[model samples]
Target: MDEPRGDYWYNLVTGKVEVGAQSDWTQLIGPYASREEAEHAIEKVHERNRSWEQGEED
Candidate 1:
């Protein structure tokens, strides 16, 4: 895959941290500023879900 110029991405289908968009948009989860952020994408999603469940807003 050709590296796109942008933030890192987390490929949900492959569960991998990519330099940018490396897969279909539907299968990717980020324009995260860093690879570390992309790596924790799932955790962030769960955190948001839990916060929403508790009626919390950022």
Candidate 2:
């Protein structure tokens, strides 16, 4: 059987990584696969936005 992957969230209001859905939906960024990914959620979003503005596709 495959191991279960945990859900991680990035709190937009507090700018912190959470283990799960512990905050209000409006303030959380996502269900990232890992803590490290959750920590960089904002950075990833900004990067993607910039790419879109430059006519680039990921």
Candidate 3:
């Protein structure tokens, strides 16, 4: 059997995952092993973006 690859979450803006190889920042999103994990990460990105936007309004 093939070894299972672990899931990873990539930042949309920074293009860096919590765990993974470095790559072109702009082109990085995810190599997640499952869709749920990817969705979770995306939620985080959205939360951060919202916070930043709010901060900018201040």
Best by TM-score: 2
1-58 per-residue lDDT for model 2 (tens digits): 6423568899999999888789999999989988888889999999999989888543
Quote the RMSD, in angstroms, for model 2.
4.8
Better of 1 and 3 by TM-score: 1
In TM-score terms, candidate 3 sits at: 0.42
lDDT of candidate 2 at residue 53, scale 0 to 100: 84
In candidate 1, which residue ranges exceed 4 Å CA deviation?
A: 1-6, 56-58
lDDT of 3 by residue, 24-51 (tens): 6465577777545754777777899999
Q: Which of 1 and 2 is ahead in lDDT?
A: 2
Clashing pairs in 1: none
The list of candidate 3 runs beyond 4 A from truth reads: 1-7, 10-27, 30-39
Question: CA lDDT of 51 in candidate 2?
Answer: 86
Task: Please give each candidate's TM-score.
Answer: 0.76, 0.80, 0.42
Ranking by TM-score: 2, 1, 3
Could you give candidate 1's per-residue lDDT for residues 1-58 as a string of tens digits?
7544458998888899988686899999979877777899989999999989888554
Residue 22 in candidate 2, Cα distance off native in Å: 0.7
What are the lDDT scores of the predictions, listed in order? 0.83, 0.87, 0.64
